[model samples]
Target: MNDTQSVNATSSNDTMLVTKQVHEIEQFETFGGDIIKNVRVGWESYGELNDDKSNVILITHYFTGTSHAAGKYHPDDEEPGYWDSIIGPNKAIDTNRFFVISVDSLVNINAYDENVITTGPASINPDTGKPYGLSFPVVTMRDFVNVQKSVLASLGINKLYAVAGPSMGSMQAIEWASAYPDMVPRLISVIGTVKADGWTTATLEQWTTPIRLDKNWRGGAYYDQPPENFPNEGLAAALALVTQSALAPNFFNDVNAQLLAQADGKPDLYDIQQSPVIVQWLMERARGRTTSMDANHLLYLVRANQLFLTGMNDDIEQGLANIKAKTLFIPATQDQLLMPYHLERARDMLKANDKEVELVYLEGDLGHLEGLSGIAIHSETIRAFLAD
Candidate 1:
């Protein structure tokens, strides 16, 4: 049989078709002492499950991502999921060898994407028959991991070969190893850190500034308003900030003309209301992406990221000491957002505990996003780590 035939994937053409599945919980207790009822989330899986279920790999997505980790739901689609580069038959993740599953986080930023099924501020409150909005309980990275644990339990797969993700997915991966070290044997964190530091926490909070300042946001109560009244502009601006933060200045330079060229081509001296070409370009992209996202959900995600602390509590050192999985961290060499130092700090703490950990740099100018779009650069590294 050919390589594709040996795997659960459809064809050797490298295009796989997958379906989104749903998981529900009657009541979910958050890490912050809040209880959410009738919770449901969307999940998708690729590859075959071994008889012993020992080859399961859980892929937790980044802040703006969904469960569609790889494959196209439709054949003619222009783009696949975010990490399609490294996940496929004979690819780094190699669906032929492992069962890969990715789930949408509660309050996922892509909540409005038709492909995403998540419970967040935009989801209706079972108790009030209204969108949860600001009323939704705060959920942290640990809370996201706990919800994923329940999803795994439902599948009768209690143990994992590895839990991997990029950015915030990195947080969930570390949280999984911390909360259930015995259940996970390997952990992969791409552009991730074990805990959110003070500076990092404050930086994340900046993304929320635009959303709150939009008067139409109406304190996250605009869900019932007219479509035009929704905080689209605010959300768009907020997403622009996020987009700028995720990418490196160098990456932008490669795709767009140099700032000097733009300055000479266009007259910036005439109109004070006019924005720079690069900034305008970023805003347009953000506006398009946020057309389907919720403003309140963006705010909630920022808060959730701010609340992340390895084990979701004090004494992060103790939490680092709790992990049992073999760990690998791939931080972008030029990442300005999470910064490579995030990996260094985690590496130091894990070493203090005598944990088996290794570090690799994702060499690219995409900055923090190198982990997402540049993962192919280190696909072999991931394959070997998982195999070992």
Candidate 2:
């Protein structure tokens, strides 16, 4: 057994506490042919590991999310981890039976969060002792899995019972199944696409345009700017695109309809600069998401996603054939960002390659977000798949 001490991470109530741990690699190489030294990433685990370390289930987090997948950090915290609904004692992920692990991605956007520890553009360069900024080497989905693989290896884990994630996390999961076919035996991809299609890649680029146009962005060298001069507007705007794309219109109608008008009983439409309450709501939603986000990091994330292809292979079919894991796809039917067609293509490709694949749709108006918020509705499906 590994020498690491057991820590309680999965709980159904506030009494359980979760602690963040960091993993460092002396030097790391990027798929794009760049070298980074002293790579560090934060990770957390839920449940206990069995003998031989074979009960491990790796959970990759989505973009805009951290490594906190379940449990509360403190007794009085406002909420547990994001996926608490399906990762507890008797939940779908069933921490009682599976040792679930999650890691923070390199260049994670939530750099300001106290619990997150990641290396990225905001990290100090050991050579120059300054933030890397735009000089940071480009990273991709494959890089994420590689780092995760290193983490698992450090824990003496050579095989994963399952590798599962949603959206960007799903991309990482797919990469794991492809890159290390022998290591991962099961793949659970929720609200994911096989590859970044042309339409989706362009849309992701559009999300970054606001940040690039921001006067304070300064070609991603705005780290020295004071908080007041930070590119909050651009980051918030970019987040708004992500938020709206992940959710359906009903969310706006339900949450922002009453605030659409001014106290004077007038609509917010008289001037070109005056935005409706819904628009302002979007901005505030993004603003409150985490103001410490770096614009350069956002741009890098966009590029990483844009450059993603099935297994990073020139031929998509050959890449799909590399997967040896039994795959389960749970896609949100109303997802706009990664539409049903995207998952369909992946499922079809896996089937064409004679891989074991199963698909179940999540029916909800939350669009892409259903993979998170509406996942519990399909708990039985997940439980059965894991059992299989």
Candidate 3:
């Protein structure tokens, strides 16, 4: 087989196929008492916007994603959406009937170009008139949703066709349904549980370690020199952690193989000297993140995920009771990262709440990636659910 074919052969069966773009938005607020007046959000849309705008689908992004969901920014572009395989024309998302939208999460630190408006520790504080850096307030999923909520309000949208996402993004999606049950009609959570597990909390800290150790990090104040020139050791380490096990174990291995092939067979070596994509970006960016956000916020979002007792009739059962929209929970059968039981738990929770919930177990070796890579396996399922 040719090199590209060989690479494709080892890839997870579910791959995205669509065009995407990075966009920016301005003037947003968060629950953490911080207001980002000019927020940069990279976004992508699929299908035409209906005249009533009721067909709009909002996709919440994970911690590291930009708003580049599906289709190319321009006709000649080659890159597809991170989850393109599942959402497009007649694909799982069924662009023919719905207008799909996905936006970059707050403080997104990926390969997005500078034109995308973003605010993190890297952004200047409007109050002090200086970069917030480590001084930026800590944020949470509610804070994130608050910002997106502002975006939706600006567009005159009071309700959403659906709110969907994975991993950290899934946490926000669930919160959107629970926190604003009056505004959402459906929730599609893949390979994500209601609460952040201890396993996740511990693993997430590794992403923050690298930035803390860099001398140039200057406690998040190295704005004068090249931000890229600053110590990226922490970010590199964090990237390695993600590259290794953030997704399903088997799928992680599959992607590992593809990434290795892209590196011409040199394994375990990320391009650090030549790029900022190494594992250290985690630490460099996470320095102010942990503190800037309220410890209560972390406890809230995480506990909300962990406490996602969908089936249990306990305190705040009213929240689950209020989720009137149909729900779909897709879990990776072989997923070691999230474990099949986690999604099962979510299914049970919603069912116990007497909510209309459907469970679709994705079959693939891609583990957690099944949530994304296995989009083809879910096209009919998603279409059917959305149609209802």
Candidate 4:
């Protein structure tokens, strides 16, 4: 089992499980013309609220990820931590010095947990008493950041030590830094871009297409009576795209070989979990995303990601002027989703703006997966930046 799996088995020993509380914030008239009412926010903190409450570091999670960043669900379990490598006492993001707060994204695929307060197509609308399905308002990266700010405000945290994340989470981190420059002073953006490019947008659209085109989608209302196609096929197709985009080249080949070795030439069922065989399962997990998050939210977030021209001054002589924090732009050289060239561009932009920026090209074949995999490689750099 992976270290995370082993830790999952005995999580309660090293972590605390606060009551998963849901707070109803405000209703938002989304960009897509759908009204999102009583948006619920769920959150947890992994350290004490200091006397000053200034030791807060917001850790945003990636796509297809849950709010369980680490530790045991209960107090009696033996597992270590989820980000045990980068978080905790004396680790990169030492829990001893910093209070780390990780939150779930709105309408994210992993938004079903009790600890995750979210609003999307799958949520039951107070007005209709039915899942919004496709009727939910579309959201954007900026909207998500605004919600997070609301959560922070509710908790009385007016400023942050840093905001960090990988992939989609990274996109939010950048937006948070740019949108609320005075709030976040340190930022770690990994394996992502300020804006999603045409290629990336096409990729996201295709990922959703597999599910949308399935007759089972029933015009996005397949909750009670899904069709035979069930969009599971679409989900699977999307996962294939996800896998290809997230992992580095040849990772599957290596995994396949390892699984075969473990089987010792016998019928090997190892890694079936990560294999294409489980596409249906993965598809089901991604089903019925918030309908209110219409094409507009997608397009908005995509544009937000694609339009990120951080260092470009309207005039070259003006230099880089917008950035306010020290940024660490770490992208995998083999990244398939957000290419390495984007990081190079970011570095130039930050440099132009006279901001302290560092670009560390993660050297790994894990491709986009290097964001997670390469964390260990540059954990020290991150630690030092946090310390600074």
As a TM-score, model 4 comes out at: 0.80
RMSD list, candidates in order: 3.9, 2.2, 9.4, 7.1
Q: In candidate 1, which residue pairs get closer than 3 Å at backbone N, Cα or C atoms, i.e. clash?
A: none
Worst 10 residues of 2 by lDDT: 1-10
Cα lDDT, model 1, residue 66: 88
Poorest 10 consecutive residues by lDDT, candidate 4? 1-10
Clashes of each: 0, 0, 39, 27
Instruction: Give one digit per residue, the lDDT tens place, for model 2 in 286-367.
Output: 8887465777888888888888887897777877899999999988888989888888889998898889999999997798
TM-score of 3: 0.76
Which candidate number maximizes TM-score?
2
Which parts of model 2 are misplaced by more than 4 Å? 1-15, 258-264
C-alpha positional error of residue 353 in candidate 4 after TM-score superposition, expressed in Å: 1.4
The superposed Cα distance between candidate 4 and the true structure at residue 92, in angstroms, equals 0.9
lDDT of model number 1 = 0.86
lDDT of 3 by residue, 218-308 (tens): 6656666664555554555445555455455555456555655566435234644544222233334444333223121222233323433
Residues 273-302 of candidate 4: C-alpha lDDT, one tens digit per residue: 444423333344434443212322232333
Model 2 lDDT, residue 10, Cα: 40
Top-lDDT candidate index? 1
